[model samples]
Every structure is written in C-alpha cells, then in structure tokens.
Target: MRTEETPLGRKRRARKINRVLAETYPYAVAELDFRNPFELLVATVLSAQTTDVRVNAITPALFAAYPDPLAMSQAAPEALQELIRSTGFFRAKANSLLALSTRIVDEYDGVVPGRLEDLVTLAGVGRKTANVVLGNAFGVPGITVDTHFIRLARRFGWTNETDPVKIEHAVGELFEPSDWTMLSHRVVFHGRRICLARKPACGACPLTTLCPAYGEGETDAAKAAKLLKYELAPGREELLKKMRAGATRAELRTEGYGLQA
Candidate 1:
C-alpha cells in the first residue's frame, strides 16, 4: 500500500491520531509517583528500564530515608544500590543518583533546576528526563520522547528517523507547545495499552485508522500467540469492564487502574 508522506497527509493523520488518543486517555498523566521536582527527578532516573509500578514500590522506602538532595548526596553508594537494586542497573544507577544529588546539593542549593539547559547538566539526566522534569514538575513546555512515544511516532509515520532528537523536533513542530505535555501523556497511554512494540492489537486500537503501521501487527506468530497466553489479573479485568461500562479514564486512574486495553 502507498504510505502517507505528503505534509498535508501527515498532518491530517497526526491530528486524527492525537484527537482519538486524547479522547481514549483523557486522564493521561505521569505514572511515576512523586511529590516534588527532586522526587520526580529521582524516580525518572530509577525508571530507566523498570516499570512504573516497580519504581513506585521502591521509591517510598528510598525517599523516606533520603528525602532530599542533601540527604541523598551523603548516602553511601552500597546503601543506595541496595535500595534501588530491584530497578536493575544498580551500580550505575546508584552512582548516577549519588552524583546527581551531590551536584544538586552543592550547585543548585539542593533544588532541582526547572530549566532544561540546567537540568540536562545533572548526572544521568538526559533530554527525556529533562523534559519530564520540565513538563511535570516545573510546568514548562517540553516533548518527552520515551520508548513509547518513539514507537508510536514511528508507527504513525510522524517521522521516519530513529534518532530521538529528530523525532522530538518533528513532533514539536507538528503540535503546539502547550499540547506537549498532554500529547506526550496521551501518546504514552495509547502506546502502553494499544500500540505496543509487539503484536499491537490494531484491530481494537483507537488510532489504527490513522496509523501507517497498523497492518504490521503480529509479524511473528509465535510471539503473537505468546501474547495471548498472558491474561489480565482479576482486578484488571474488573477495571477494563468498568471502563467499557462508561467509567471515565480519570475516574479509573483515581481508583488506581491503568489503561490495559
């Protein structure tokens, strides 16, 4: 099939995808549990390859002991590793966190800098982390291109490049700055629940009509069958049923349920 490449065609597809995603996940927001900029910075660093649930579980204890940059700066590397070991990459993550905390304490007066330029200067804080902190904690406009966002952007034909900077620029140019945070959240929600990396259920996906990669579903039959073997938990089933029965996405999130479909 011929793919969409023209500017008008791309814009139309993006607009439709964005509108449906916004409606599908009206309450989309950050899944990481954090109360402040520092906590968010720490959580984002810990969430490198870990699930939000896992990060959330670990942070309560981690933050309770080292509540701020000053406290965390003085934390022993081994002790910090023990606390976040479950998130994987313990040694590297621990060192990064320690260095980040020390820099924040000594340089920024123990405060997470709101500016992207300054935030990216911290250890382990890349463009994605900087954008997350800016958008979520400081209310600044930023487009965070995480794995989900990148996958969905490519799937939807927003950009053909694999480099994140190009993808960020493409998306940033397409959508208004004000929509950056909300758009990122919505795209992430859709990616996690529908536009998954493997065996995306495009038939039921809200953005399938607008997505160029919709027909690429189930390229591997073995993986597709394996996906079917994993069923949602009883609680998750109840939550999906409730959502189908007219519960708002916000209400479901408030009740501690994530979008699974």
Candidate 2:
C-alpha cells in the first residue's frame, strides 16, 4: 500500500502538482463561452450533467434572445425550454433559469449579485455555481470543487473528503487566496486532458513523478498520447510539438511553476 505523507509533505506535494498544472495549462479557463456574469451563470447551470461544449453550442442563441435578467425573466417558458432542450432536464432547468432571472430582476434590480451570499440566494444557484461566477466574473478568488477538481485532489493526495465544501476548505489551506481560481482552472484542465475519469494518460503526464496515483491509468507513452484531448490531442499536433520544445520542467519551475519550498 502507498504510505500517506505527513501534513507538511502533503502540502508540499499539493503545491508542486499545482505548479506543474500551471505550466501545462498556462491560459486554462472555463470552456463554456460567455460575455457576462449572467450568461456565465446561465451557461454554468446548463452545464450541469452536460458537457461545456454542448453548453457553448446553445448559449449564443439563448443569450441573443434573452440578453439580460429582465429579458430572461420575461422569456416564454415553452420557448426557453425548447432552446435548452439539448442540455437535458429542460423543464427543470427552464424553471430554474426563469425563476433565477426573475429573482435577479426583482431582488437585485437586474444585475447578477456580486456577493456569494446574494448569488446563492437566487434559484438553482449553489456553492459551485457561485464560485464559478465569483472567480471568473467578479475576480473573486474561489476554489470550484467540481468533479475534476475533486478527483485530482484525491489522486494527488491533497484531500480524502468527498464533500465539496470540505474538499474546498482542505485544499484551500495549501495555496494563497490569489491562486485559488486559477488553481481550479489548471486542476480541471489537467483532469480533462491527462488525469481523465476513466483512463488517464499517466505516461504522458508531466506530474506523474509527484502524483500519488501515478500508475492507476495507461502508462505507455504511445498509448497514453492516444488518450489526449483537444489541444493536447492529434488535431493539435503542431501545438503540442511547440509546447514540448519550450515547456521544460526547469523552465516551467522558473516561471513559478510549483510551490515555494
């Protein structure tokens, strides 16, 4: 069995993993496209139990039709349901969107509330959604403990707790507040690209040396490379070539890639 690290050792390892993630995904961010907090909030809600790409596919038309809370609040329920039908749970999601939009208009005067307390008070909003809005929209740093983040956290030996709030607090103690939001993005990116849910590309992972669950997935370079996604995949071979040429571990570490030791 793998031995657990001391508290300080765990903290050091967590920061190191985060640092490598920072280099691997220098510009990592939400895949869901949106122009404003309201759009992000709506898109994120639609994103539940669905892919971000799917959410992005539908949002342009959705946003064009209901550009703001007041407009969204007044949207015809059937029309709204049809528009978001592809995202799944159309009726319930539609109800949430309309109810939340109505709340935003009636209570917050059409502006999506900036405060976490206020944001969560809106219908269908939760801590995760609130964190996404706060971090991306308001520039407030927050740890979004999504499935990806949660999985990576445990794999990297950061936290054992499955409860999102507990996971958030546990991992939160490892980094500076300013790092929380980007940290979430990087971790999520790594989870999707390398440390995947079913079969992780462990052999191609830059952090395999630091990851506690290193051998849990495909550990052959040829096979592992086949498992990469998006820009890290065969379609982006040229970009991967360029990234490999320049992004060395030493170079990445020099760019504040890992935690201070």
lDDT of 2 by residue, 155-177 (tens): 88888899999999999999989
Q: Estimate each model's TM-score.
A: 0.86, 0.90
- Mind giving the per-residue lDDT tens digits that candidate 1 earns over 1-261? 256378877877687778888777665678787899999999999999888778877898999999999999999889999999999999999999999999998998889998999999999999999999999999998999999999988888888888998899998878889989989988887777666687686555655556678667754534443333112223355765675567764566688775433
Q: Give candidate 2's error at residue 223 in angstroms.
A: 0.9
Looking at candidate 2, the ten consecutive residues that score lowest on lDDT are 252-261
Q: Among these predicted structures, which one has the highest TM-score?
A: 2
Candidate 2, which segments miss by more than 4 Å at Cα?
1-4, 239-261
lDDT of 1: 0.81
Superpose all Cα atoms of candidate 1 onto the true structure and report the RMSD in Å to 1 decimal: 4.0
lDDT of 2 at 149: 92
